[model samples]
Target: MNKPIVAIVGRPNVGKSTLFNALAGQMISIVKDTPGVTRDRIYADIDWLNHQFTLIDTGGIEPDSSDIILSQMREQAQIAIDTADVIIFMTDVKQGLIDADAKVADMLRRSRKPVILVVNKVDNYNKMMADVFEFYNLGIGEPIAISAAQRSGLGDMLDKVTEHFASLKLEAEDDDRPRIAIVGKPNVGKSSIINKLTGESRVIVSNIAGTTRDAIDTDVKWNGREYVFIDTAGLRRKSKVKEEIEKYSIIRTVTAVERADVVVIVIDAIEGVTEQDAKIAGIAHENGKGVIIAVNKWDAIEKNDKTVYEYSNKVRQILSFMPYAEIMFISALTGQRLYKLFDMIDFVIENHSMRVETGILNEIMAEAVAMQQPPSDKGKRLKLFYITQVAVKPPTFVIFVNDKELMHFSYTRYIENKIREAFGFKGTPLRFIIRERKEK
Candidate 1:
């Protein structure tokens, strides 16, 4: 099932990142020294009160200095409307209400997406209750007081946030057919790909429908199987500014990947791989979507026997976080290897939802532990009690242990590699949930 999405929107210095860290249980946006790990924590998978949803930090991008504060805040609110099921419009009691706050609130109210107005930096609710009430003038909704720094009053705020989940159409996009999202940088032949596929003998299942958020969904049948393609192409260059374009590109990809079982990230062969490409690919990696890297405009580039090998190595190095992602060189113009692209998509989708038995998973864990002892710190070695698959759609696993703190990142990675060795979970990222035993 697809999880609901919640977005946080507010001006700078309203404690947006602090609140995001509090809800996510860690400092998620911190830049990691690891090579392939991206610093952009634009979105996170949140499990709160037995409720699962994806939380987006809408302020991840930068605000152009040339633009006024109101314009930037408006852009942020617009993003929340386009991508979120529930919007958390945060304000600072310290800063109080401003003209920008009221205007943004009006925008969110008109969008009709559930908006939860919150006032941050209210460490002393009793003392700051008066100041919090000032936020009611924004005319969005009742302002829930929260001190993200103190981490108090959050339960009340989250309760209000999750209440809207039941009413959201979380399952409205679900169907038996495999859903594929085509994502890439602008002008990477994204539109050409959809055009080529539909221009042929392939049957277009239905009329291209435009969603309320303005996303286009096309249904096509290939080889007697139906697939839904979410295309993030043909964006008008209204901004003209480079940063704003990148910001919008990421937003579109985030929403598209949320509904996809498999994602095809198209790349420009002439431009080769870039940092922006790595960032875009990381979105699919973070969402646990099955990934395939398609190098478009292949016919435009010079090639030799070693050209493919050289190109693949460069992509793997840059996108090292998703080494399992399938790589193929295709030409939307010449239709080179486009059929193989479909074959790879089929293989990836099958592996994406594949599940393994509990007995087999445990056996693999046992053998892996015997091969290399678990890491020990100050004589408290990590003890793995059980490992079992609790869900599919990337095959989530719950690993029970004596102490959660004893589980090291490297050790968890070791276990993950062992699982991969036994069963090839190619093109899909695996999620591991660590639970400590509640012993008396």
Candidate 2:
């Protein structure tokens, strides 16, 4: 299901990152005391009492900073506010409601979207309680006070935030198509592949780089299964991109990858793999998205049978950690080996969407632990008692152990490797949670 989006917006250094970390349940954004530390929008999936939503931590909106960078940051935040289903108007109790805050509040009020006013840095009730009342005059709504740095009052604030999303209709229940995104650097033939898959000129194809400026979404059905394809704009280095539109396009591309079930990274067969390609693959791997490396323009490459094999091996060497991702060589212009692309995509999507029964999960866990016992930490044997699939659509599992602290990172990787070997969940990222088992 597509989760509702919540954007956090306020003037410079009002604890937006602190509030973002609290809501995302992780430190995805860098929290610094300096203003404008968060230059781009950081997005994460937030699960609040079983209801999930996408949270966007936007750069602070500074109205007076005529500096180019500050102006760009404000523009990015405005883009997020426009795209969000609900906006969290954050303010600082320490600053005591400045002129910039009022200007931003006016912008949010004109947006007409549900705005949840949050007054951050309220550590002492007596000292900060008076500042919250001043925010009410912003004309948004009742202000919810929170101390993001101390991690207090977030639960109540989230309860109010989710209330705004109560009206969003659930995504269509019966449709089970896996959402796949085609992402890569510029001039990598992303549009050509999408055109071939959809059998139409759905996207403009040009030899020029940075031709597509937004992530375009379309649906296609193959073999009685539906797949939503998102063709994203080519991502360039931060130095190369100077315009505001290109900057937002890059943000949208990253967000699209986070929301996708599988990410198909296209590479130029002639150019081979580059650092930017590795970076894009890393983003997919970190976000737990299924990855596929597509080597486009293969028909143009002067090659023998060994050429394809050698290049594929080089790609695997560069992306060693993501060995599970399948690599394919195809010419998007000539439709060479294009049918195979669909079959491979379908197989990966199935693996990505696979759900293991609880009993089966436990059985696999028992056998895996017995075959290769976890290393002893200080002479204490790690005992894994139970395993459960907490969620699907990439399949996250929680394992209850005797000592959660005793579970080493190497051993966790071992268990993940074993599960993949047994279940054949190729082209999918698996998440494991280690929890301590309570004494009986």
Candidate 3:
């Protein structure tokens, strides 16, 4: 099943951020420089009750006065409604039923999307029960009380959130077409690449109806097989205001990356890779998606013999986490190396889902252990029992060990390198699960 997206929406100071941190257990934030960058909770991958979903926090800007809270709330609510399958509308029990909360509730009610009303900051449930009831009049749904600060009642809130997963009609699991996300900064020829791809005569799939501009994926027919491209760079903003254009770009990028099997991170060849490009590429890597660093507008940059090597080194240095990512200098404008994109895409997709047999995996494990003995502490050596493939698509492996704590990251890195040497899992990140087993 496709992982459903859940977004949190509410007025500022309504405990949205606190609840987001409480739920995600890790904070994801970005700070813009003098050019005015985005700073918010952004998005996180959350797993609750074995149900995995991408949780997006829609409130980035804080509105000071009560008069502007309505408009701000609307902005947050709209983004959530546009992207999320289920939304958690958080309210402050201390604030106690503001007019903006009621108005936003009406707006969400009209969208007809499933929403869970949450009342937060109820440190003492018995005393704050009355304040929680005040939110019921919003008419969205029953208000679930929580104390994000104390980390209480989150399970109930999450249970209500994951309950909606069964109803989510995601792109079917059996759809084998590799989902490639064309993501980059605000410019750098995202739309141009999308235009060129769309101009092709073979893209026969019809546009999806009734989806937000960000939600709809463009289908392209490449090599007689249909390929679904999640074009992040091709979005046309309704608000042309430069300052506000990037506000929701991260939200869209997160949404696109969440659903993508492979991420084509388009970068400006002229500008080379910037910090922002690294940030965007980091998203794909973090999500364990197959990545291809496409240097767009390759025609614009003046080339020398060392130009390609220099550019590749710079990108690798900036995005050092993904050394396995494939790099190609492409011109979406000239359609140079555009067709080759699909071939790389196919290769990476295979590697992303590639698996090895248990016997061979154990053989490699034994060889690796023989080559380098396991790390020891105070004469007690870490014992490696067995290793086997547990899953695919960023192929996950579980390593049974005598003591989980004894397994050092460097040792794990060594094992990963051994696996990579045996089989190239290029363009995809591999995940490992360490489990403790009693040595027989």
Candidate 4:
């Protein structure tokens, strides 16, 4: 089911971006004290309880006849309000509800969408309670007091927001198919690889940078299995992206990576791995997405097996931490080794989404512990009682042990390697959690 959209709108410098950052659980938007720092509609997935919604932090809405920049900002806010299922009409509690906020409130009231009045900058509950209540006169609804900077009262506000979108289901029921995002720097043949896998030119193959502005979604059926592929815009460094469109494109790419179950980082074989390539790979690894690096334009490289080996070694050196990630040498233009790329992707996706049974996990853990017991801390040996797969889509496991702190990083790595070796989870990263065995 599609997640409902929630838009945050307020007058200039009313902590819209701050509140957005708090709710998004990340600093996606650039939050400055200056108004209009958020010129574009920034989106992030907000997880509240079991409910998920798309939260959009739009530029402050100014009067219709304001300056060009403010007018553009107002236009963007209106666009967000129009697209939103729930509108958060944010006002400044410290500023005591200005005239411009009233004007914006009038517009939101006319919008007739579910509106939740948010009184921001309420650092003191007792002092700001009256100020928050004054917003009720705007005739939208009861105001929820919050301090966006301190991230206080956001829980109650989010609870109300999710209430509006209660009809929409948040999570996917079917867990078989994995969502893969094809991401890379500009001109690295991302579109070409996506086209080859899907067997259609769904995305326009262009040599130009920033050709794909928005993230495009497409489904591919390979080996009698379905996979969702998201083709995102070529992400450039923030300093290099001068245009507003390019900046937003990078934001969209990051959001795509966060949502994806796996990410295919494409690199140009001729150019070799650049710093930007490493940055993209780092984002995938940080997000715990199953990553597969594809070296495109392999046919154009002027060398034989030795060249491929040397280049692959260099790439591996850069991404040494992600040992589970598989690297493939493919020519997106000539389709050389392109078929193997999809096969590898499927293998990684399957491994990332695998769920190990508790009995099997405990058996593997027992064997692993017997092989090399965890090191002692002050003669207190770590006793691992059991292990269970807590989640899939990266295959997170929790190991119940006697001394969680005594399980050193090296010992934990040993258990992880043992599980991988026993389970054969190739081309996928695994997360291990060591917890103390509680006495009943």
Candidate 5:
């Protein structure tokens, strides 16, 4: 489902990051006593009650500041404000209403968007409650007293924020196409491949648009089908991430992977697959996403007839865990075999959502058990009553056994292999859910 976006905006040192951390339930944004500590915009998914929305924490918007960094900060916050469905205008209760607060209030009032006035640093309820009323003179809305540091009165504030979502129309989700994410280490041609796919002359789908401020996601149509391409920041080595914004970008990359239905792991052809490449591919596989390894810059490599075979063997050896993933060699610069890559993504998506009937599943289970009886545990042979597929998008199956503890890992692997052989669920992971059968 497409969730509404909410932005937390305010001047420097008003505890915007603190309230953001409190609501997010983790330290996503770095909080400090120093002013203007947060320079980049940080995003997180927030689930309040039955409503869900994307929460963005932006750097302090110093509209009047002439400093280069502060001016850039203002621009970043402006982007958040323009993209957000609702805006949280936070203030400091101790500081009272200052000129800068009034200035920002005027700016928000003119924008005519839903603005929730939040009073932060209200450490004491009774002492700050009286002071919070002073913010009403700004003519925006009722000031909500909250102690982001103490983490109090957040439920009431969230109630007020979600109420506005009912009035705002969120972006519609596209269920027709597979959301493909392209991820790799830095300097891996992730961006180049996307640009090539959605070239100016290409049949780009302009119907569905992304609400995110970053234009990393592009929608394109190919072969009478739509595909949403999510371009992620190249995940850098931990030691190389020297700036705070780079750390936040890493979080964005994870969010992209979680939202994608299929993940295209791009690798450097000349460099081959490295440990970092394995790690990136592992994340997609572990998350149960249909994975495809695309070796970019293939044209740069001097290759013979056996060169492709040799390189593919090395890739499989490194990513042995993701045996289901298909490998394709392409050159982003030359657009070599680009059409084949798109077709492979569609093929994987079809298998990712593949489901087998219960009767067929049980048939496969019986044959597998007859061929090789489940391993004996202390002379108590394991008994699998039946098997049924419980879900898709990973093709999860449940095996009803006499005792769950008796289902050894090797036996489960054998069952999974049998199911894969019976039905071609290629380019997707198979998950076995073991359960103890209850006798009537």
Candidate 6:
């Protein structure tokens, strides 16, 4: 689901990162006493009172500074304001109201987006209640006071923040067709593949123009089936992301991954698989989404009969962690072997949501245990009571055992292999949960 976005913006040392950590329930952004410490924007998922929203922490805004680093910080702050659905304009009661504070407030007001004024570092409400009112002169809105260090008055702050999301609906898989995200490094032919697939041969399903926050979700119908394709922003190395727009593109890519049912990790066949390619695959694998490694730009590579075979082997070696993912070779420019990609996407999505019967699962487990007994620890052999399938979409199972400590990682992996061998779980990851069986 695409969650609503809330961005926190203010001058340096106004506790924007502190309030961000408090709301996120973890320390995602670094908190320092020094100014300009946070040069990049940070994002986190926040859930409050049955509402889920994406929270963004931006670098401090110094409008008057023409220095290279401070100007970059101001640009980063502007990106947050442009992308967020709700803007949290924060102020420091300890610092009172300054010219920069009013300047920042005017910026938010001109955005026309819903703004919630926040007053931070109010350790004692009675002593600072009058001080909070001085912020009302900024003309943003009512200032809600809170101490991010002390973690007080956060409930009231969230109450006001979630009010903006009442009309926004979460992204749900209401249809049977699968949602696929095309992700890879910059110039890896991600955009080219989307253009080729949605051309004259394919039927364009939705004409909704995509906005910066929406990530350009394009729908196409293929051979009597339906699929939603999300074209994620191209990802670059941290050092190369010098501009403001480039940094926010990473966040858009993250959001695209979260909303996809299947992810196609595109790799440049000419360059072979890279560290950045492996990192992108890891993100999809960690999310438990069905993955397919699409080796793009095959037309550019000098090829022989054995070229495809050698390239596939190299991809497998680099992404050893994702053995379950299928690999395909194609050229997005000339449209060679692109039809087969649709079939692979369909296959992976079917297996991702597949379910197994309990009788079959137990039969497979019993056979596996009989073939190779689980390892013992000092004569304490593990006893398996039974096993049952618990979830789908990266198919999870729970096995009741006499002792949880006896279940080693290797044995669990062995069991997972057996299940896959019995029921083909192609293009998807499997999870196993071990729990102690209680005596009746």
Compare the candidates by TM-score and give the number of the best one. Answer: 3
**Model 5 TM:** 0.67
Residues 254-335 of candidate 3 have per-residue lDDT tens digits of: 8888888898998988888877677677778777789898999999988899999988998888777788899998997799
The TM-score obtained by model 3 is: 0.88
Query: Model 3 segments beyond 4 Å from truth?
Result: 26-41, 65-68, 124-131, 200-213, 233-247
Q: Could you arrange the candidates by lDDT from highest to lowest?
A: 1, 3, 2, 6, 5, 4
Residues 1-440, candidate 1: write the lDDT tens digits.
67888999998889898888888866343334223324556677788889988888877655556346777778778877877899999999999998878889999999999999999999887999999998889888799999999999899999999999988877565477888898887768776787788775232222222112235677878999888888863333245566666666777788888889899999999999877788778778777799999999999998889999999999998887888899999998899998787789899988888899999999999999999999888988888989999887788999999889989877998999999999889888888999998544
Query: What is the per-residue lDDT of model 4 for residues 1-440, given as tens digits with 9 covering 90 to 100?
Result: 44577877776677887888787755343333212223343666677888876777664233345354344445444544545678888788878966666666777778777888989899899976877888888888889998999998998998888887865443466654667888887778998888888888888766767665446778888788788888875423222333443434444555567668789998998888776666567657755788899999989888965987788789888777677888898998899998887688778878988998999888888888888867887877888888888987779999888877888878888988988888878778888888897655
Clashing residue pairs found in predicted model 2 = none
RMSD, one per candidate, in order? 4.9, 5.3, 4.7, 6.5, 7.8, 6.2
Please give, for residues 193-264, the per-residue lDDT of candidate 2 as tens digits.
Answer: 999988999887777677664567889888787888888754322333434333444455566776587899
**TM-score of predicted model 2?**
0.77
In model 4, the runs with Cα more than 4 Å from the true position are 1-13, 16-117, 123-143, 149-152, 169-177, 233-250, 357-363, 438-440
- After superposition, candidate 2 runs with Cα above 4 Å error: 22-41, 47-51, 60-74, 91-112, 119-139, 142-156, 205-211, 233-250, 270-276, 355-373, 383-391, 396-402, 435-440
Query: Per-residue lDDT for 279-381 in model 5, tens only?
Result: 5675576558899999999999998999999999999888887778889999988999987988899889989999899999998999999999888778887
Best by lDDT: 1
lDDT (Cα atoms) of all candidates against the true structure: 0.82, 0.76, 0.80, 0.74, 0.75, 0.75
**Model 1 residue 399 lDDT score:** 96
**Model 4, CA-based lDDT:** 0.74
Worst lDDT 10-window in candidate 2:
30-39
Candidate 2 residue 202 C-alpha distance from true site, Å:
2.9
List TM-score per model, in order.
0.82, 0.77, 0.88, 0.74, 0.67, 0.79
**What tens digits encode model 6's per-residue C-alpha lDDT throughout 202-227?**
32223221122224667888998888
Off by over 4 Å in 5: 3-47, 52-123, 133-141, 147-151, 164-175, 183-187, 198-219, 230-245, 251-260, 271-288, 304-323, 366-386, 398-418, 430-437
Clashes of each: 0, 0, 1, 0, 0, 0
How far in Å is the alpha carbon of 388 misplaced in model 5?
Answer: 3.2
Sort by TM-score, best first: 3, 1, 6, 2, 4, 5
Error of 3 at 360 (Å): 2.2
